[model samples]
Target chain A: MLPRRIYQFFLIYLLGILVLLSLKYGLQLSDYVIPGPKTLWQTALEVFPRYALDVWNTLQVALIGQVMSIVLALAIGIPGRSTTWFGNFIKAAAYNVQAYPIVAIAPIIFILLGDGFLSRLLIAAMICYFPILLTVLGVMSEPVADVEHFYRCTGRMRWQLEVKIRAFENLHKLTTVIAGSATLAMAGTIVAEFIAANAGIGYSIRIALYQSDLARILVALLLIGICLSVYQGLLEHTGSLVKKAWTGSA
Target chain B: MNGKTGKRNSLLAAAWILIVLTLAVAGAPEGRAWAGTLNYRLKWIYNASVIGDLYASGKGYFRAAGLEVKVRPGGPERDALRELELGYADFGVASADQVIRAVAKGAPLVVVAQLFQVNPLQWLYRTGKGMIRKLDDLKGRTIGITYGKNDEIIMRTLLAKAGIGRGQVEFYSVRLDYTPFLRGKVDLWPVYANTQAVFLRDKLSRAGEETALFVPGDFGVRFVANSVVTSEKLFKRNPELVKRFVGALLAGWKAALDVKHQKEALAILRQVDRDTPLRILKTQLEITRRLVMPRSGPPLGTIDFEGWRQTERIMLEQGQIKAPVKILSCLKPML
Candidate 1:
């Protein structure tokens, strides 16, 4: 028997294909509106080689932004876990930042930063920052009474304990947050590229849209989906390995 | 089988039939008893650039031609040709360069009517800050360009022809907003002569500043601008419909450009786009009339094959397109 997760994935894809086929044949819709699976596959094959550079450019921006976001989140979120006014202020700012939509903020970012790689990086970081910070705050604040008592008995500094031990104890949550934010980072990068960039999958999509090349647009979207999935998959796999090595579980 | 089993089978058959019927209805277009529905996707937002299209629809010209027209506005993300390809739209407006590139990529599109006889794309620079008496003045000046757009292609071609290297002029990436240009960061900015340039000029004039327009045509480039297009399949299958649509569209253009019908055309345009000022619309209409039907040029909606060939040639030289797109085959003149 197929594994449960694989079977579920297969079933969803099968349903999508069935719907496309029904639109193509049952209703006799033109190929322009909903292309058949075969056409999509052919388009993917044709455009993948030509657009590899755009994909790589997007991936680089996303990865760099993700790393920057992680570092910034840790710097602020760890201190915000403390009982101080500054910490509370930092938490409040993160929450406020999360409230504004990226689309609304992107044009302002472009104007201030002058439409360069920095603007794209800042946009991606802005999107990835809040989620990671909030997750870190949640994990740090929810220390178990028993764990706290044990750590206090050991006489370690509270900040040191929180940073080295408490945070480590909740590695699973941190990993999950990081994995989730990867998608947001990718999306933010694409949005930034769309508003202002010299090169990227987003730029390619814009050009393809101008040309009315649906096949190229579909290919770009597929590549983006594939990029995000692979990134998420790797993070999850590595996260599991780290969790197993640290906690001695499969 | 028992009575209950028989009843369940009958219900299942009915459900399947209902599902099929619903799907069919959802896929089909909304029923039109007499007039054929034509979805026209414009290249840009509802502005002076698409005044003719708006006029035609608002004045019942399309209705006279048996077409119930829906003039949809396009933006940065909307590709009229892509919509045409997907059957979301029956007609679209795009630049010659865009049409050429699409055809080279195997899109089944045919140009039916050319709207702008001379391309509206040109560079605007502040004359008071510095004079650009000759092409050499462009050197060392910061030029703003929206890369992957036709302006970028035109600018690069101009530079190459002028023997100017990439390092001579700094290229700034242009966004939809003109803050950088307004703030004097960019020395030269690209604008549609008949549309955005009118608004920019008005604002600058109010600030007691003067600007000089640089026409690419004057500088040795005659690339065609917006043109009406439809799928080749439609052109082949419904030649009569294509003829009627083009005839009505050109008639609308002629009226919109005529001085006598200026107020009516602008009124029609205002009905669709209320944001643009009346003064700007009047100036834009004047400029558009000149561009669409110059005193010595072909009439409105005439497809100039030589202009298209030049556009394709420029694209090929710039490596914007891989190969020469058969320009002649893609053009289907209905007027």
Candidate 2:
């Protein structure tokens, strides 16, 4: 699965670069507009070590943020799953909070938190939280009536048991949602870095853009794609491991 | 259920294909012209700095020249030089760094006019916190600069010129907000002398704080700022149109910056820059005149050949560009 994910990313990234190169040669665009292959390769060699470290720093923040969001989503989703007034209020608030664009709120976050790890973590968590929250809410609220009815009738069903049963029944869905949110978490971190933070691949890309070096930007994008692919693959692999361990499957 | 899943996947695949096709079509470059139409892109957003470009379009100066020019606003993200090469724009305003960098990369870009003879990008410092009377005064100062922006290059050059190492001063990364500067976390903050400087100086004064500007040009860091640029093809293919367009554009600038035309210029600026109060806008225009056209300087939109060479040399020395672009050859002053 990890190899496939990495391979797919390479395919798509190369295709995109191919299209850009086609545009460059077709329209006779200079390296300034879309860098030639030699320039791009040379830039990759020049900036790889620095950008690699930047990507790793970004991934660390994104990992912590994703964990926080997952915890936060579950904490809220479990409580907000019921059809009570408070539950509806919680749902409404979450929906409304997600409506505010993160880009618009990022400046405020950076101003209050400073452009450090905290700001990037909050932004990543905020962006990665909403989708996970919605999914968790949807999954937890849903009932496995056949199995749940038997548990309730036998007086064996507690709130914890109910959540476990629902989550167990929709294990594939929960796994998929968690794995998919890795992209959002990474993207959120990059956006945070691009907007304010002085470190990370996004900041490097911003510097490249300032210099109008498309070659450097292309190299940065290549590094981001590879790191993101591996991270997302790891998330999916971990999700599958949890499922196998829970079910005691082969 | 299987059929439904297949249908959904098919829809997703179709959507992806449509997106790819749309991207390909949009990315293809062609000199899009209709009825002698022209598109002129700016280096930055609609502000006092672009009074001439705005006035040219607002006052129908282009229309009088039998050209339907669309005067587009620009931002930091906008690359007018790239647009010119892409055929998305017939003419554009690019910084000297952008032009030099582009030329070094073999981009067929030519500068037809230099808008600001004196680079307006200056550092704003609060008065009580000590003055930057000389380059060494910048030592130990927490200077604010946008890392990838022209400000960083200029600041680095300034520091080098002062024989100051990076360790001497705290380099603060500037963003959209000036909170750090306001809260006294940073000392000298970069601002456009005409636009942002005017606004920031006013805000400081109202809060009972005196402020002053530190212009790099005064200290002999004559990095060129904005200039009118065009593709070599357009400049060569249609010299007549280029001449008329630049002529009319400069005329608009001449009129707008003229003391006699201040009333009319303010009225024109008011339409686009509604957020800036008339009082602030008036002061901005006044400051712009000194930078753009001094008493002994060449006419409005005049290309300063010596300054262009100096700008290229600075970039070479700083290693911003790997090689000299022979920037003078690119300066084809239309007038």
Candidate 3:
């Protein structure tokens, strides 16, 4: 029997294809506006070889930004759970950062950082930072009292108790947050590229829009969707594995 | 409490109705006399390039022709041709490249009037850095282009004609900002000669620097620029409306190019685009006049058939279009 999750995914995918087919053949929309799936496939075949560099560039930006954001979030979030003024300040700053719209501020970020890889990286990192940081802070602030008492009875140091026991206990949450942030990182990287970048999938999409090449535009969008889906699937798999190992159950 | 108060209320309601009827009767002639509403989608934001369209509306030309025209400004993502295709706009301004590409894709679009006699796509380089006196000077220079833009086509055509190899020069991709050129990172940058070139020259002159424009027209690539366009369905459905709109638009163009009406045109343009400085608008208007009505060319708004044919040939040679788009069939000049 097929897995329930697998069945659901296929159902959604087929529904998407159905809608596209209806738009193309049923409604008889112009090919210029909405090209059929066959044309899109042909365009992908033609564009992918030429767009390999763009794919690689976008992947690098997203992956690098995701890793950096995770590290920064952990470094700040653990200490931010402390009952102190500085900790409260850090918490407040993270909330503030989440309030600003990334798209509106992207141009300002580009101006300050200049239009290059660093600007794109910073934009992606900014987007990925808050969710991971907030999740870490939430887990740390609500540590299990029994675990704390047990560690205290064992005479463990504060750093050791917090880092070794508390973090390990919340491994599921951390992995889940990381999984979620991965998607945001990819989206942010693409948007940053759109605002200012010479090479990336976003740049290719912009060029396609200017040329009014509907086939190429659809191909670029499909590639972006594929990239995000693959990354999310890997992250989810890793997250499940971590959960299973930590809890000693499937 | 019943009959007296009800009679007073009825009297007040009747008086209000009489007043409304009087107002409607007085305003009906002007309000109901409009022939139709024309949604004109411009190719870019309100600037000197669209001064003629703005001028026509400002001078009551569209209204005089019994039409209510809504002049809409376009931006980076706002494609005039796309708006026309989607039925949101009745008339639009698009470049020859856009029109050709749309027609090639079976868009059923037709060009009604050519705005600029000469294409405005050109390269701007600092004269103080190094003069591009000859075609060979372009070799080894870092040239900036917005890939997939008409400038790319024009530049490639120029290079191919001059026998320059692709590897001879580096092509940089330009974005919305001009910082790369301003920072000396790019040797040459593409710009609309009449619009952006004026602003760049003014900015550079203030900094004690000089810049020179490399017009592709001077290099034998006379691609047509912005032209008024409408869908074939609309053109066939109401040719009279098309003719009236074109007539008013061309008259506005003539007036805009005339020195006597320059002040009036600039005034109208400034009302739409207040951010641009007055001096910059003057300079832009002067360059725009030269482009629209060259000393030794056809009068303003004349559709140059040879120019369109050459543009198509260049696009074909560059492989931008896979097949020939019947250039003349798409051009229906009502002016």
Please state how well chain A of candidate 1 matches the true chain A, as a TM-score. 0.84
Tens-digit lDDT string for candidate 1 (A1-250) = 1244344444444544555566556544444555666767887787798677798799899999999999989988888887799989988888888799877777687668867899889988887878898888887777766767787888864776657677777898899989889988998888778777777887788766654556677678666766677777787888888889888994
DockQ rank order: 2, 1, 3
User: DockQ numbers for every candidate?
Assistant: 0.17, 0.49, 0.12
**Reference-based lDDT, residue B111, model 2:** 90
Pairs clashing within candidate 2: none
Query: Which candidate comes out best when scored by lDDT?
Result: 2
Ranking by TM-score: 2, 3, 1
Residue B6 of model 1 has an lDDT of: 93
What local lDDT score does residue B41 receive in model 3, on the 0 to 100 scale? 95
Docking class of 3: incorrect
Q: Where is model 3 more than 4 Å wrong at Cα?
A: A1-21, A24-29, A79-116, A137-173, B1-36
Instruction: Please provide, for model 1 over B1-335, each residue's C-alpha lDDT reduced to its tens digit, 9 standing for 90 to 100.
Output: 89999999879856765676567558655322224578899999888888888888888898988888898898877777766765778889999988887777667899999999989999999997577766777899999887778998999988888899989999987876787898898989999999989999999999998998888898788889999999877888788888988899888888888899999988887887699889989999999999999989997999999889889999999987778877888988889
lDDT against the true structure, per candidate, is 0.81, 0.88, 0.81
What global local distance difference test value does model 1 have? Answer: 0.81
lDDT of 3: 0.81
Docking class of 2: medium
